[model samples]
Target: MTRVPFTASCSTSIHKCCLVNTINIGTTSLAAFPNSLALPFVPHTKATSVRRISVVAMSDLSKSTVLVTGAGGRTGQIVYKKLKERSDQFNARGLVRTQESKEKINGDDSVYIGDIRNTETLASPIQGIDALIILTSGVPKMKPGFDPAKGGRPEFYFEDGANPEQVDWIGQKNQIDAAKAAGVKQIVVVGSMGGTNLDHPLNSLGNGNILVWKRKAEQYLADSGIPYTIIRAGGLQDKEGGIRELLVGKDDELLQTETRTIARADVAEVCLQALKFEEAKFKAFDLASKPEGTGEPTKDFKALFSQITTTF
Candidate 1:
């Protein structure tokens, strides 16, 4: 038997040089190349397969300016901070409703004060952003004169002009419109998991119909024709992230399970991960996590997002 050698080259601006080396073991020719190549390993009939693998790398090194609406909120702050930490890949910007909220994040220059409910205020923050993460939601405040010691459920209500319809539906619609007009590439929306049921307990909170209105915005975003990722997270907890097995489902199915809550930090991480992967695009699903120590913590976000097939 005689050994045969052939030169195979891949041309791309992403890499200085991409070389594919083919070896013949008997009648079969196997191609060996860098794992960075986007193609799967397969037996090649000829050296021309090298051209097939000449595609650009999946990871984009260019920095994207990402704006986090509601950046003062628990999960939003985490996402904003994570992006700021990854300065090489992202130009992180935070949008808060008030100056006090801005001060909470150390009054960073990157933080922008804006009212998500008002489209006019969002213009400056939405300008020239490559992506937008919508973390804004209506807040429900408990009515006065109630105590936990009383052992009775406290009533809830949204402040004047801040109901679910205004904040969840209209505010989000405005953001979508503004982002679309700005030529934003991607949008990641974090919402609650109970949107499937109109009578879900959350909707009854403050007579706000929160989930109902949120579902409306989710659909609007889906129809906007812009690439989007909608994450309806279940029962957000303040626990540590990256310590539990994250799960995804559709139509609030995960709400029935005991593991129906996820950490705010994990939700923040998922929001950022949605921006990195193509599979996470145009997808919407319920997000939850198993109890810590029950299984291995979720690390491969690409695999986790690949499990979702739903659109809105």
Candidate 2:
């Protein structure tokens, strides 16, 4: 690194006054220096000689270590890839449940295989993490015996031991507890919209009560005393992101409008943006998007987060 030499000479009272006001080093101000670095300042009186000082600019601070649970999923994969792409900002790691999921990503050693439901299994993966993004949720699938051709509606069921209660509720609670133990700085959790209704149609899917359980986990995270951002996303679409205007609402209010669905990529972007802005902390809101090409895409994430005032 090149060291720049700064010179200060106070021959008159006017020169001393100018030195006391402020000193600008390139684009950095004197006040921006760390408290550990002691910079010389001119005394009240005028000096007789010029003082030359060698200034060595400091390097950038260390990057934060972030862990994404459920990195094997579609949205989680996006978040993990974004973090990795911004390597100067974060040290990204992925947590998956199976070897197949890990292989799917062609994951290096940074990817870990562990079950979130087993609290003991999460200890190692969660250690030393600066932030945690919870994306794990129970998935409902159609029962094999149900024939769509002969049925009014296909029957659904969660895999054995992977119901909403076990995955969304208990598993998320375990991750929260692990994060607390590890002293994580922040957490960003993604949940679905329509949680305000107790008898919503999603709850009837396999009787899993998915939204109810997800709401319970969100409430638990809110009460955990850690800074957090909770996003209750509307219907998830497989389309491209950043082509439609994103909207934020409270208590599923957006679900009543025509813009009730959002792309999975947009949701992934919001999860990352939440970590960049303090306004997103300790806030909860429903997220959706307008039809593609209707209006300008969302580029001001700080302003978007500022529009939300809900805590849960």
Candidate 3:
């Protein structure tokens, strides 16, 4: 066997009869290929036996200016950090409600104070954003052990602002309207499951019917005609992510009676992926985690997104 150096300039596939054998790509290794697949370099008698691959140079280092709603919250904070880590691809800004919330963002200058419930306050926050990643949700004032029927768990709506009908539905609508007004190209919203069935237990809390209002907002988003992706996640648990495999589906296809849950970090990772990939655009899907395992978790987010259906 012999090795040949590939130059910065090369050309091929100029005609119908193109030969695809023993191809060499830069920074690529044998481990990149599947074990059972036929090597493109292998001798092939017919065209059907070989698949064509286009190698285009990726020179676009330009980044999108992204604004994250609920940036002070659990998943929103993670999403903000992940976007900032990939600064070459994304310029991240955190939109928080109060000065205290703004201080939580690592003392970053990108933190902008704004409340989503008020349309007037949202314009400056989304003035020049290219994409909006919304992780905001109304906080239910109840601990894990708290039960409403047992003389506990009150103030599900919290203060004057944090109600489900206002935040989950109207707050989202305000964001959508602001995004459209700003000429933003894409909107990625993080919501939860059980938005379909009226009997789902999540609705019983505060009689808020949070999922129902969430669905209404989702429909409003879809009909807005903007390039959008809605990721309806399961129970949001505060745990370490990147270790479990991500599972996704459309129209609540993955929903069941048993409560499914996922880590905030994992959801944060998916929110970034949804913002970046065209495959995730114009789609709404449910997201959950499989479990802890020794095998590697799925990293091909575009492929994972493509398998799901759209939210028409």
Query: Against the unseen true structure, what C-alpha lDDT does each candidate score?
Result: 0.86, 0.85, 0.78
CA shift at 232, candidate 3, in angstroms?
0.5
lDDT of 1: 0.86
* Residue pairs whose backbone atoms clash in candidate 1: none
Model 1 per-residue lDDT tens digits across residues 1-312: 233343365455433323334434434565544435543434545532334323323333356789999999989889988999888788899999889999988758889998878789989999978899999999999999998997989999999999999999999999999999998999999999988788899989999999999999999999999999999999999988999999999999998989899999999999999999999999999999999899899999999999998997
Model 1 CA deviation exceeding 4 Å by range:
1-61
Writing each residue's lDDT as its tens digit, candidate 3 over 211-233 gives: 88888898999999999999899
Global lDDT for candidate 2?
0.85
Residue 214, candidate 1: Cα error in Å is 0.3
Give me the displacement of residue 107 in model 2, in angstroms.
1.1
Worst 10 residues of 2 by lDDT: 13-22
Error of 2 at 148 (Å): 2.9
* Candidate 2 C-alpha lDDT tens digits along 90-158: 888899999999998878888999999999989988997889999999999998787667858888999
The estimated TM-scores of all candidates read 0.80, 0.81, 0.75
By TM-score, how accurate is candidate 3? 0.75
